[model samples]
Target: MKICFAVFSFLFFSSTSVFAEESVGISVTATVEGHSYSSGGGGAPVPVPVVSYVSFSGYAYPAAKVYIESDSQNVASLSAGVDGLFSYEVYGITAGVHDFSIYAQDLNGNYSQSVSFFVDVPSSAITNVSNVFVPPTISVDKAEYGIKDEIKFSGYSMPNSSVYVVVNSTDGSLKSFSKEVKSDRNGYFEYAPIANVFNYGAYLVTARTLYGGVFSSFGSSMDFQIMGRTSLFASRPRCSIKSDLNRDCKVNILDFFVELRWYKKPLNKEAKKRFDFNDDGQVDLADFSIMAFYWSR
Candidate 1:
């Protein structure tokens, strides 16, 4: 009887070991509108009125319980299907970045490692698609300027509307500069610093139009550079389109007119160097193709 008991104990230990080895941990994968998440990726900046959806799907031990959370708030809890597949969706996320976490627990009470993702939501106050409000537009006099040099920043908005401007250094170290002014009778407004008063570096300027104390959710932004002694080595301002003649941050009919006016005209050395998108010694259809690629972008 003692020998029989010893044999039974050995068999029990071996079976327990086999059970532990067969129990695999869960695994998860997720996306926002079919795009996988990445740290600081910012996803695609979308206007606020559009609905954003996040979907989580993954494999777990068959019949396992899966729990998903957004910023630690439990958003979903469900059981994996017979094939070990589990899926869930969270909707109506508000403006700003949000964090999503998902994990699973098997029948054996083993918990899987949580998978996390980040999504960024841009501000948009428009609720009706048909009545979309067109925000004001802004522009800078030039792309690059010397430190302390006067730079004229201007834009168009609703007549008599208030415009708020915010300027910040791109290097991520300095405090932002801000000012408020009213649009003129013709819906035009301009702001120039009293003095350069800004550190020498790349800067981003954004402006929003305000009406009756409410401001546009997604304001317009532009980039410019403050040239320093070492600016030659610094990053240059990005030009989305070589044919943006008015520098209004777009290539549209205005640019087409500028190109038409200079079509086949004798090009100055600077104009040839800057406007010659094709590098074939002139601005022509070849350059127009490049501009068309970025139209309305």
Candidate 2:
């Protein structure tokens, strides 16, 4: 029995490896071998089909990379569409209760906490797992801060939603603080400390977004240390305004030119995430006029 098990393991490990395609927002496929009947194996064994069709669909940060894992092994990796939506069909899975985990990394390089679940798949059966929302991509601008310096917390989540930022002292040298920040129409959010509300110590920060009055799970935790004497200068929040396209923190001619590329054009969900200022599903004079309001801001 032990020799048979060893031989089986060797055969499995020595098989060809498959890789995911380098494509954005597409289904992932792989090949796996199924068991077949052998006439000279001492006895006739029943054949079992290994094919299982399962699809996973969900939302994450815009243009983010979504990864899928099963039993500590990588299954598939794909990018979310511009609209923050992603779906992938996994092929060559065996029929069983398979454990799976999903996570995403936003365009800003922030990685959200993973969402895990299991699926009871039958041979030749089709199953779909949808509405799997990846948690907010979270980050801190810096890993160390002065006592009086503003700690900027930023991330991406559902557009037009409310983000809850939580700050707590990991070493108990400071009090826990939390507040609600608003996500912009494009799902980017940031909160920079405006007052000298911190002490000398190590702190942890986390964030989550509320969609339709429902809050999502808290994402991965980030920590920072406040060392040495404090600085008297208070850090000001950057111009993270929604209309600042080029991210130069200013709405000027450069931003205008970027927006004009989609001028008067029918906008898709991804395009609307950045250009659809009015949420009318179209980019026209109305959207451009709104951009005019923030010009030079």
Candidate 3:
């Protein structure tokens, strides 16, 4: 399979490239900006009402419906291409700090999480928003599973991309399973795990997509209880495991290597906060031991 990167359309006019960084649904990426006045504005220009524009380019499921709203009002929408790339320009936008919310829905009815962020629009200027990533949506077949029941999961990611599904127990037993599956041509994927979820009081399942060079954070989690042919009410929230430094829902060699880089080395504030698993203001053997305990192997 061939991987494609997003291609941006550069404007004809010369402008200063003043770049800034902002995070989308999952992780941080380039949100570059080419500062320039509106098409109607001249060297010394006046504020033109409804003359500013905002251009957005990002990735979503191929042929998916991408929608955007400004300050809770539907402003624009576009469809992603076959490579899951989408570029849209919203014209006549009044300049100011606007709250823009974006999301995507694939043809198979998978809906990504709504990502909301603030954009400061310069008067009569063009604001460009780039590197937006739409997260994959996930759902399960049932809310309750019997001991012998098979676990089924379905979601939509970028076409031909890999979907990682993870299951963890919250009744405190730490029984878990993690697997990766590929999406079909339409970015639709389904998985039925072979692992038996034994002795589970409650389990939390979530999914994320890895496409091209990027992946998203796990979407809405599904909570199901292991009942003995009887319906029961049981649910409690499970926060992300701190030991999983990479946030891939597993503490394996990938995580081990991530923490290993800082072993015994002076940690930056961010590294100390994340890699210092023991919270003792140091990255030592104890931190690695904690990661080993939550290895999820």
Candidate 4:
């Protein structure tokens, strides 16, 4: 690309000599006036309306020949080579703040001043908004009485500023338990609800900007649920030496002798329930046989 630029420059300068018999030469120079934006009339900081300049006699160019451009593709532009004045409106531009520069090239390949403007698009209905990230459904600790349920809430913001979340019940009632969060430099945010509050139930969560005037319409909503905890010991009875159906203290084939001896006796229902190690729910020959099958291993 550099080589192409060099070749193009060489051809362009050589061609200018034919237009002016006095061995003419063309070069580019530009200045972005003030090098920054001004809050016009002290009302509120608006986007710099235009980049203005005066050109010295270098090359006679047609007014319809030059074009003005901005670094950002979305920024608007206009060209007037007649008086070297440029005015443009950056349409659908985002709110909060922005920075951009403007430059133009003459018909004869001479560039004018490059003026950079720092713009504060400010909050308004016409301002553009964007949401860069929407956090995934975060897992909350299953609810156990007296234990806190904690889950993080996060997402990104454009023209990043304060963010708000509305925690709602499954029935669509607005929660008094809502909170606000701030976005990071990279548009990241983290929020953990207070402990001992949320219970096991479905929830609907929605997001919005605190400065809604600028970013109200850019956010989305999500849903999540906190479920009840299951006890590990609830589904099975405690094991014991005598309860070893196979007569192995570790519960193998050796315990089968004791089980066979007391098979007809009044067996503990809990022991019988747990002794169904084969998981068929019947404390019988099959359970004993399975224990014997894996006894040594």
Candidate 5:
């Protein structure tokens, strides 16, 4: 009986040590659901799928179990095959960024090294998004323009983030373009609209931040318009009187005269814009007349 027990112990140790010198390693990956735009070939990054793989040096089977945990929850369990290979599948994940980890259990219940990876889940909730940003918000500190003129633009975004400004007409015609600007560490960016590209009309202005690996949420947008001087005069606000070039206690024909006086001289762009009330491309009689027509209000 003692001899039989000794032989059994030897056999058990030998089987467990079959691939002891071969070594084993594991890897994992995840697939997110509903995270891609049909227009784009690839889905945005999503929660990584929990996949575990065990590799052996030889044909010996893996004498171990694989385990996976996410957010501290034990989610996967599987036994390695004879060739020391294994895998796990995870599902029913939500949209957003999530972290995952993989682990291995030896025959002696010894836990192996743990590995981690990141995944980003694109939100399908926000539709019609042109692009996503890492630091997803941009602020346009100020935006204003003269009558029949395009708006001046400037803003801030995540540092190193690429910012784009697109202006589209109601008819889907893209006009008045500008190049992307890289933000500084302070998250500041500044850009202007292509002056001659836009005519007097309503437009959609979209500002975005771009990133790689994991896509950010879509950017924010606002509606803006360009109009001739007549429109500005008609809608002149009470506070704008301070900008009266003619000092008429309000902005009117006299301001047009003040601008006309400098027409032949080197033109002051701001003065010309302020007095060129009609925005007829040229600040002449048309602008003066438009200003006169609305001089009182």
Candidate 6:
């Protein structure tokens, strides 16, 4: 009986060893939609149209879990199919260089060596390469702001041309503020909106060139925020009640309109100082609550 038991154990150990040997390891290879940096692929930064999205595709071990990382942050993950293929799309990638890394891990927890590649999104200001005309560029002086502060929106365009500026909510649901400003001899222009033109929230500011009364496509936008008065002065009643964006001494639809114009976008330093109701550096629902509290008051 003992001899029979030893024979069974040996058979079991031999079968397990064969199964382990048959298991495949995880492997991954990836590339940007238009770039090729792989081995034997001439290392060149492929030029992609300056757009807001980028797609990545690659192969991994079948039935493996794949992870896509950007700037050391895991942006996305997916499961490899029977064909050992994976693809992912990243949205709102602004003009710049981005490094994306990918790796795979099999069900048995065996990980593949990470593969990485860089994608370049050229600036809209960089024209003349493909006969494609990119519009002018605009920028805010800072990222946040206070209630009664002046914001300097500046940019460059064709020399002595007319540039139109638009400040609106990032969500595209609010009334936008628009103005036409002229560039100088050097193609530089600046627009300083009236103090308190924006209310407690975030905003997207964009600029486009005007030729013979026709506006060109807007270039990339600048994001900024306006903070709530309560955030600026938590202990002072006089300042706490300063949510009156229209300065009519009351917060009403007019003020709400101001808030709507810039809601749900990023903020500048000065705007953030005013709109970050909770002083959290973000103009989120918490800050909106503060604005709602002063509604019609």
Best by TM-score: 3
Each model's C-alpha lDDT?
Answer: 0.60, 0.71, 0.70, 0.42, 0.45, 0.59
Specify the poorest-scoring 10-residue window by lDDT in model 2: 17-26
C-alpha RMSD of each candidate structure in angstroms: 24.6, 18.4, 14.2, 31.5, 29.6, 25.1
Instruction: Name the 10 consecutive residues with the lowest summed lDDT in model 5.
Output: 52-61
The runs of at least 3 residues in candidate 2 whose Cα sits more than 4 Å from the true structure, single-residue gaps closed, are 1-51, 172-175, 228-297
Give candidate 1's error at residue 213 in angstroms.
2.1
Give TM per candidate.
Answer: 0.37, 0.57, 0.58, 0.29, 0.31, 0.34
The residue ranges of model 1 lying beyond 4 angstroms of the native Cα positions read 1-131, 229-297
Q: Please give, for residues 130-166, the per-residue lDDT of candidate 1 as tens digits.
A: 1112244566766777776677877654457777877
Estimate, for each residue in 41-156, the C-alpha lDDT of model 3 and write its tens digit: 34665434443478887777888889987876778888999888888988877767787767787786655665667876776556778777777777766667666667678887
Model 5 error, position 13 (Å): 56
lDDT of 2 at 191: 90
Decreasing TM-score order of the candidates: 3, 2, 1, 6, 5, 4
- The runs of at least 3 residues in candidate 6 whose Cα sits more than 4 Å from the true structure, single-residue gaps closed, are 1-131, 171-173, 212-214, 229-297
Best by lDDT: 2
2 or 6, which is superior by lDDT?
2
Local error of candidate 3 at residue 153 (angstroms): 0.3
Clashes of each: 0, 0, 0, 15, 10, 25
| Candidate 6 Cα RMSD after full superposition onto the native fold (Å) | 25.1
lDDT of 4 by residue, 168-266 (tens): 766655364566777544334557774346666556555544432333322323445554544333221223223455443344335666556544344
Q: Count clashing residue pairs in model 4.
A: 15
Which sections of candidate 5 miss by over 4 Å? 1-144, 147-150, 175-178, 212-217, 230-297
Higher-lDDT candidate of 1 and 3: 3
